[model samples]
Every structure is written in C-alpha cells, then in structure tokens.
Target: MKKVLAAVLAGAMLTASMAGCSGTASSSSSSKAASDSKADSTAATSTASAEDEALTCTLNVWGPAEDQAKDKGNWLPTTCEQFKKLHPKWNITFKYSACSEGDAGKTVTQDPSAAGDVYFFANDQINTLISANALSELGGSTVDEIKSSCSKEIIDSVTVKDSVYGVPFTTNTWFMYYNKSKFSDTDVKSLDAMLKKGKVAFPISNSWYLPAFFIANGCTMYGDKGTDESAGIQFGGDKGTEVTKYLATLVANPNFKNDADGSGLAGLRDGSISAYFSGSWDAAAVKEALGSNFGAVSLPTVNIGGSEKQLKSFSGSKAIGVNPNTKNPQVAVALAKYLGGADAQRSHYKLRSIVPCNTEVLKDTDIQKDAMVTAQNETFEKTSIIQPFVASMKDFWTPTENFGKALISKEITKDNAASKVEALTKAYKNPVS
Candidate 1:
C-alpha cells in the first residue's frame, strides 16, 4: 500500500559541505549577465505557498544519495519544499538513497510493486522493469513537460515502444575533464601531444573508459538512430569490439595508465597528476583537486583501428519524475513542471554547478558566458550517452557492471571483449531477446 503524505518541513541542509559558492536568490537576466559563473543558492524563500496549507500527502523519491551531501537544490528535501510551497494543500514525504555501480541491482529487488512514487533511473534498468510492469508508464501528464524543461536526450534510455515512462533525470553522458595547472596551452591541441607529452590519469575501474574511448574513436557506444535495432548499444555487436580496441589503445599509451583511479582529481589535488577522463560535474572536484590550477577539455579523440570522434566527458544530471501510483497526479505533474522550469533548474545549478537541461537556463548570461559551458555544449550534443538501460537497474546494469569489471581487470581481454559483451548482451535481453 502507498504511504500517506506528510509535510516536508525542516531538514538541515547539508549544502555547506558541498563544493561551490552559494546562490544569490536572484534570476534577473541583468544580474546574471556579467558573470559566467553560477553560485550555489539556498536562500529560504518559501515561494511555493501551496506547501503551507498542505497536510499528509507523500511523494516517494529514490535517487543518488551523494546529492544529499553535495547538492542543496536537486535532492528530496529541497525539491519537495519547492513543490509543497506551490501546492500547499499537498504535503509530501520523500525516500532517498544513492544507488551507484555495485549497488545498482541489489535494492530494486526488494519491493518492485511499491518501490517509490519516483526513482532516478538509468539505461541499464529499463528493459528489466518493462516486462515486470514495476514501472508506471509516465504517459500523458508530466513527461512532455519534463521534456520541455529539461531535455529529451536526458531520458533516451527510458523511452520504449514510442512512449516514455521516465521523466528526464541524470545527464548521464560519460567523458573526461582535466586540471590545467598540470597542463599547458600547447598540451591540449592534440591527442598525441597530450598523451605522450602531458600528465594524465583516468579511473580505470570505472566504466567511463568504455564509452569515452568508444566515442573518441568515432565508434557508437549507444545507438544514435532510434529506428535501427543495430544502431545503438544492443547487448552485443560492433560497439563491444570498438570498446575493446579503444581500451587497448589507452592501456598502451605510456602517458595513460590502468591503475589510475578517479580521473586524476585526487592526484591533481595532491600535486601528483595533471589530467584525465572524468564526469562533467568533476569541474568542482577538479578545482577542489587543484585549486587555482585547473583547466579541462573533452577526453582526447583517438583511433579505434580507424574511426574518429571528438573528445567528450561523462555526465549525470537528474530531473524530476512523477510516480504512476500517485492519487493526485495533476498536482504532482504541476509540481514537477515547476521543479524542472528555468527558475528551479537554475537555482539548483547555482547550488550544485550542474548543467541545466532547460536550454533557456543555459542562455542565462552567467551560465553561457563560461568558456567551459560554451565548449561543453558542442560535446554534449555529439558525445555518447553511456548510462545503463532505464528499464531495470537490477537486471541490466548488474551484468553490464560485471562486464565492465571484467573488461577493466583484464579478465576479458581486448581480443575477447567483444565476444564477452555479446554474451552479456544476450544475458541482458535474457528471456525477451
């Protein structure tokens, strides 16, 4: 049975512990026009008046727990407050957690029928849940509104059968970022120059390498064309082979190493490393890693036997989603709309330095003026979306995780990685394919 809603009153915001500066509660175009930087904003303005008159109306939310500590705006408490303030008649309770690589498959198995009103899911989980009907088809109400505010690309994995079930959440693209204090102007011009001549490190254990290299080498990591079955990462196919060779190239590079753990952020902070492949949000981490000495670029483009794409980074931005089980979906949808709008997304970005899905938010002079944001838009448009399937995190990502672990550990060699991926792909579709 679904739980009753309750007022989302006061939870200590853990924003101070997160990186980035505080946001100034102002979204004026003129105010934002001069600075290219967005600050982390958490001013206690109860703009959502609806929350005041609300009672026991709950909203179940599941997502990355890191946001709890690192982001002030996107998490359950903040978003719920914003939502409740708008619809004061409906009080909401939130369930939160951070599900990452190893823990991906374990939790969803516990309560499929009533997991939460909404969950922040990825590509690996989609197919598995589709057959089980554990997921509610987002259908008519809120999905398009989400698409309008956030982006359609953000929810690509959750789209199936010409219909969308999940609202856009998690930018979910993978690539590399660098610390410039460790590099120079000449170092970034080319891949060969940077790899053999500059300092670099990458988190080998993280599957970021697969999609990063696959795309850098001009190979398809996920399908680009929705209509073509073989176009995207469909279990096992050309993509797996491309992934194998791409890994081989990086391993062979003397400037790059397999033992590296975290895109050189730790090393940059410690003054031992200079550059590496990583996620977009790591820009803050990079600054934390090498304060006053950080500059990053898209991961270097490379040759996979001989295909070529530009360098890019891994991304994971989240959006608001509505639960199918909600008795008052109209209110939920309205709240979700407000949450994903420019005002809310911009505020959240100020709090977390997350790139906004609302294209207009990006236009805010403050955000658009940044050199990195300008450079990133190009990459974001072209790079691969490497998140796990959105249907079923348990069934899809676990096998993919095992495959990733195997690939990184050399248990699956470059020569055989393709075949292994094919096996995993078959396993992914399990009874269906």
Candidate 2:
C-alpha cells in the first residue's frame, strides 16, 4: 500500500517544510511514498568509455518524492550515482515522482519508448505489468536467489500463475506506539475504559484500522493460496465485509466517538490518546510527536477464533524493476541487483529509517543497532504480509472509499449496507496495468 494509493499521498504531504511522521490517504500526504521524479540528476559528464566508441550515458531511474534528495537519499538518482562512482562505465539518469497506484508500472506500459532503464513500483502492480511483458523477467538464477532471500508470502504475492516478477525492498506493517505516561496500568482500567475517556490515536478511516481491529478480533488479510499454491484476498469478502461492519459498530456506538475522531496523532500529543497503530517507518517521528512519554508495543490482538486468535501487522516491501522493453535491459538488471543488496539497502535504512527485506543485509551490525531498526525487527515477527486483491482492489478502492465516506459521514445505514456494498464491490475491476 505504501507505493500505491498510500505512497502517492505520503510524498505530497511530507515534502520539505512539510516533512514529519504522519499517515495520510494518498501519494501526496507523506514523504514515504517513493516515485520516479524526485531523483536529483547530475548533468552528465558524457565521457567516452576507454574500451568502447560510445560515450557512457546516464541510466534513467524512477522513484518517489523525497524531502531531502541531495546525494540520492531515498531516490534512485542518488542511489544510481553511488553505483556510478563504483562502475564509471554505467551512468544513470534518475527521475523520482510519488506515483499513483498503477501508474508506476503503467508509466512504462503506456509509453515503452519514454522510460528509465529501471523503475521502482509497488509489489502488486509489478505482477500485472510484468505478466503483460512490460518489465523484464529477473532471469532464472537471480529469481531463485531473491526467492531464497525474501519472505515467501511476499514472493508469492508478486508471482502470477507461475512466473515471478519484481523484488521487494520495503515491508509495511502496523506497530502500536503509545505515550506510556498517559495510560499507565493503574490509571486506565481497560481498552474499553481508555476509549471511553479518549485514549487512542490513529485515524478511524484509514485501512490500518482493519488490521488493528481484526488482530484485536483475530483475523488475517489473506486466506490459504490453495493446493495450486494460490491465495485468496480474504480480507474484503464476506469476512472483509464483517470487518467493515465491526468498524461501523465501533464508530457508530458514540461510546468510542471521541477517541475515533480526527487523525490519531493529535490525540497522542494531548495526553488524551495513550496508544496508536502506526507503520514501522513512522515510529521515530511518532516518538518525537509524543516527546519522551512514549513506549512501543506490537499491534494489539483482537480475539476472532473460537478460543483465542491474534491479528498480526501487514508485511511487504517496495522494489525497483527493469522495463522489459528497454533497449538497455543489462543496465536495468545491474541497477536492481545493486539496490536489492546490502550497500544501498543499508544506506537508505540509515538515512530514511525504512525497513529492508534483504535477508543477507538485514542482519548487518549497523541495521541491528539502530533503535528504530531494532524495533522494526521486533514488530515484524508478529505480522503476516497482507495481500491486496490484484484485481479486487481495483474493483474495491473507489466504492470502498465512497462507502466508507458515507458511513463516516452518516449518509448510509448498515441496514442497507449489504446491497450498497455488494454493488460497489461488483464494480471494482482489476486493472491490467
């Protein structure tokens, strides 16, 4: 979600003077959603290669918007420059834009002629474009190696009926960070009591609330992939609808009204909200927002199974892929291989505080020592990578957005929700992008 609708909103909201840790609904709301246009390009030196007659040229790279892009912090242009210094034979021209849901892949799909050698895109969309032959297959040997190194859940998500596409670099899941001083054990009796007195943070309207409530109730975002080794989008069907109904129940009750109002971070600073569900990347900022009064916990669990069940945080990562149509597939492969390894992952992890999924590098001493990094590793163990319906999401987002708006706006009633929601889901068609 970080690189889809969520990623676009993050870039717009968190740019420059706006930089801070907070969640938003679209690609423009935060600095985390990386695209291709934010890369800082160096005017090419155009030096002739010692062995070849052709001059070394820059490789065009696409990524997300960044608050601080100098020296390629978080954008491919900067990462490419770092690669260029090591391999002077390769020059990369980077462009970073916080792309909308399917646009990252479609940018190349729509115009194969106009593209950088490499592209950074959300995982699900990569499946679509890769299958359509828009992006290069990462070859047999490399794919096998990446498979062993990345999470199996994530690997399975981007793989279509059979073939695999794209590599993951970001796993986004929720963590419950709280201002410890405000909700000390003796002061608050229970979660219900805390909510009654306005002791919660995070937005009710955000998708994060689902896992929060579900784990609290005991559910997962995915169902078994089946004997064919395929999974179902279990989060949004009848069970998914149950999730919505439960949310409606919570917010409509008026008992939880005060705690559910507005963005959750506002409550954290006021001492009114003691705990919140947030992405791992935002923990440092959440700490700053709450000053010295905070403590971090894994996302809370909601008992949903017959006995007791816990909901885990979502897991997955963002990645760079090569355009299959590129005249320079070799360069594209090199770029992806580099970023997916330890050097770039660690540098980005240090500069931006984002989590890395590369198994080979995640255990590096620098990565393990950072406080935020340490916490991410702790929380990640509790999560399952939630799979969005490759096509169901396309069919789901708009109507779901509208339906959620109406529910939040008091324009719709649960009595009529079945008919309305069904019609809305029926309309959500998966895009081929």
Q: What is the C-alpha local distance difference test score of each model?
A: 0.50, 0.52
TM-score of 2: 0.69
User: lDDT tens digits, residues 252-370, model 2?
Assistant: 75434322454566666665566776765566567778777766655443323222334455545566776654443334555676776667777777766667877877778877665
TM-score per candidate, in order?
0.68, 0.69
| RMSD from true fold, candidate 1 | 11.9
In TM-score terms, which candidate is top? 2
Q: The CA-based lDDT of model 1 is what?
A: 0.50
Runs with alpha carbons beyond 4 Å of true place in candidate 2: 1-55, 71-75, 91-103, 184-198, 207-223, 226-245, 253-262, 270-272, 303-309, 312-314, 369-381, 410-433
Candidate 1, 315-370: lDDT as tens digits:
43444444443333334444445555667667656766666667777879998865
